[model samples]
Target: MARYKNALTKYYVGDLEEKEANLRLAKWIQAVEDDTDEEVEEEAYYDGDGTPEEDVISVKKKYSFEGFYDNDDPAHRFIADLEFEVGEDRKIWFKQERTSGEILEGPATVTEPKVTGGEASEYQHFSFAIAWDRKPDISKSDDDAGGGVEG
Candidate 1:
């Protein structure tokens, strides 16, 4: 088995069309979390076993990110500006690159960053949530095109 370090993961934000050229790295990030949820419905039949069956009707994928605040970073700036955009159409492209070289890209709606905590000596930190507009695209890295491998 192969092991990968979380420190090597990269995150970016920008327009999807010019993703390669325009994407800005989310710098000084401390943590990235997956916040996916599912909605299910239960169905019970009159002439069947006593156990009820549950089916997943829908799924919602999201990410919760936490990091030190940096005013100079374009990605951070973009997230901060989202606070002012109140409409449902407010969305931006995001990409995640795993250490194993798999890429996850999509458009997502971001909530305004909220201050996680503050202290007299500690650096200011913030956290925000990102909800995917739809299912994201996942692709394997060029190096892994031929075979399946776990990182």
Candidate 2:
């Protein structure tokens, strides 16, 4: 038997611990995208220059979450909360699933929401971007924090 990625699955974003805050929101999410890039600077060494040295200056990561916007859904409240605290730096993790162990987490600020779709077939969607400053701390599990308790 083998496992493969499926379209039906949704990604999650929440605190460091596997909290239920965003767990329920994951169900209403329709799409997820992660963008990462490095800022590099090229330096010329006059002492012994063969090829210009390229040094990584910094890294940037942006996470985008898109979902249907239904005021009736409880997830809508989560959106309001995020919007209300736009400039605040909140610890957030991007996980494939609520139960999945592997995750990328860091301090991020929520951006303004973007809405689309006002047609009969298309869905009314709400999209937002979370901008992170530091490199993500990837964790396999809460127990990945070195070792303490046995389970």
Candidate 3:
């Protein structure tokens, strides 16, 4: 059996290859929750009672993580550049391999980034947030991750 650790997770910004990513120093990858919810309305009729109606209202999702600080890393640069994007047109992504050899990945938008360091503290990290519309997909490999994408 393979041991699991934060280092096993990989984060990629945009379409960049993993070689240029900084996930090697990852300390933690927090779970993201899709805020999408369903709306239900119940109306009383003058005659017999009726079943309540329901509707789904999709909402923005959120993803967060903490990793070693590396200003030169492309993922870090991509996250920093997101602050300057007025319309937030860019996308961020992440992938993690499970013991079963399955990979999880999806599209995301960076929402926040926090850098923390102190005197006598050699370990520093950059924690960031992202918005997602859909939950990531789990595949056997990167090439199979397109299950979430449609041609």
Best by TM-score: 1
- Using lDDT as the measure, the top candidate is 1
lDDT of 3 by residue, 1-151 (tens): 2345433344455543332223432333343333433445556565655655444455454546665656676556666566555443555565545434576566655666655565565655567776553676766864443333222
- Give the TM-score of each candidate: 0.78, 0.61, 0.51
* TM-score of candidate 3 relative to the true fold: 0.51
Report the lDDT of model 1 for residue 20.
45
Candidate 2 segments whose C-alpha is farther than 4 A from its true place: 1-3, 6-10, 14-25, 46-49, 89-101, 115-117, 142-151
lDDT of 1 by residue, 32-118 (tens): 888888899998888878678899998788888888888777777777777667765457787777766688888777875664468
> Which stretches of candidate 1 lie above 4 Å from their native place?
16-26, 46-48, 115-117, 145-151
Q: RMSD per prediction, one decimal? A: 3.6, 6.8, 7.9
Clashes of 3: 0
Query: What value does the lDDT take at residue 53 in candidate 1?
Result: 89
- lDDT by residue (tens digit), candidate 2, 49-102: 667899998878776778777666655555545655534434444444323445
